[model samples]
Target: MGKLLLFLSLLPVSGLAGEPVALSEKTYDPSLGVLIIQVNWGRTWKCGQFEHAQLQALTFTQLPLEGANSVVLELQTHSQIAAENTFLPYAYVVQPGEYQLTDFDVAVAKSKKEVIHLKGAKEDMAKAPQSAGTFTIQPGEIVYVGHFGLDCTEEPFLWRFYIEGRSEFESYIAGFRQKFPFVKEVPVQFKLFSTQRFGNPYALENPTVH
Candidate 1:
């Protein structure tokens, strides 16, 4: 009977091999004052034979300033269009605080001497760098959303800034679209937390690969 049963077990199994397993859920909590920068490439937009491609939504948080002071956000736009040619439109600056939204008119100010019109225009202009646009992040607050772009050129375009604050830095990234009109709609959140004592538990529990 045992030999007869072994002879009858020649049929194939039902399912195939090497099936994919479901991935687990993950959560990330970065250290306080840590700037998380994310960059993505977008669809290329063209102008005649020349191409005007753009880097989409390079997002990051400005680390909180230690002393009682303001921070400057700068965007550099390198262009193929010479200075002699009509100035090609490039970048703009945004200063986000606890209660207000200020937009700096980068188009108007071509030179360092030109005024930057904003709520705290005088203070912002005073701190404005000689080569680029400037906006002031008020004390006790964080900049939520900021954007600027450079024209197509062989050289790379760079945008950089600093965050100013003392104690706990608040994350103002919630509902950024309603706050800043120029920012394109996207799923992004910038959080400000203290990096001194405790570690980010969420990051430890769920690590990100790459």
Candidate 2:
């Protein structure tokens, strides 16, 4: 059987000038047990005068094996940019027998036919043991995915999405349902850290600007 796909709507890059960016709306079909996330950056939107900007979409999937008590899934995505890309810091935890699914896609207005490709790590988690410490999840508990988006200087936008569920596997589904209830919410704290700039070789070489 093919893997289950979860669709997280294209979350717009907030804090852009006065123009409000509209993100793609997400839908989940409980009957099919499939979740769909899509985001549209719209056309002719300029990130900066000098920057070649475009809209990108990404999807991730998490799943648990039937016989195993633990669940893990390989993470990957397709983007609209070339060279390389980097994602913000994020973390997730599931029940003992639950699993997760994530997918990524990006769309740029520059080319109608070709889309930039966003790459994902082959491993189940984004952070290594040294970076991501051990996480504990209780049985029949559900915790949605936690993501942090940072800019060139590792300044957090303080945006977060949460999922609620009793079983670790069902947390994502629950979180999807909460989108309507938790509308127009922002993070309380913003922290600044230094990290490499995403998708830019120059930023990686010089960590000082991050």
Q: Which has the greatest lDDT?
A: 2
For model 1, the superposed segments whose C-alpha errors exceed 4 Å read 1-40, 56-128, 150-210
lDDT of 1 by residue, 136-177 (tens): 333222222222232333322333321222111122222223
Per-residue lDDT tens digits of candidate 2, residues 56-76? 433332333233433342222
What TM-score, over all chains together, does every model reach?
0.22, 0.29
Model 1, poorest ten-residue lDDT window?
1-10
Whose TM-score is greatest here? 2
TM-score of candidate 1 against the unseen true structure:
0.22
Stretches of candidate 2 exceeding 4 Å from the true structure:
1-44, 47-114, 123-136, 147-210
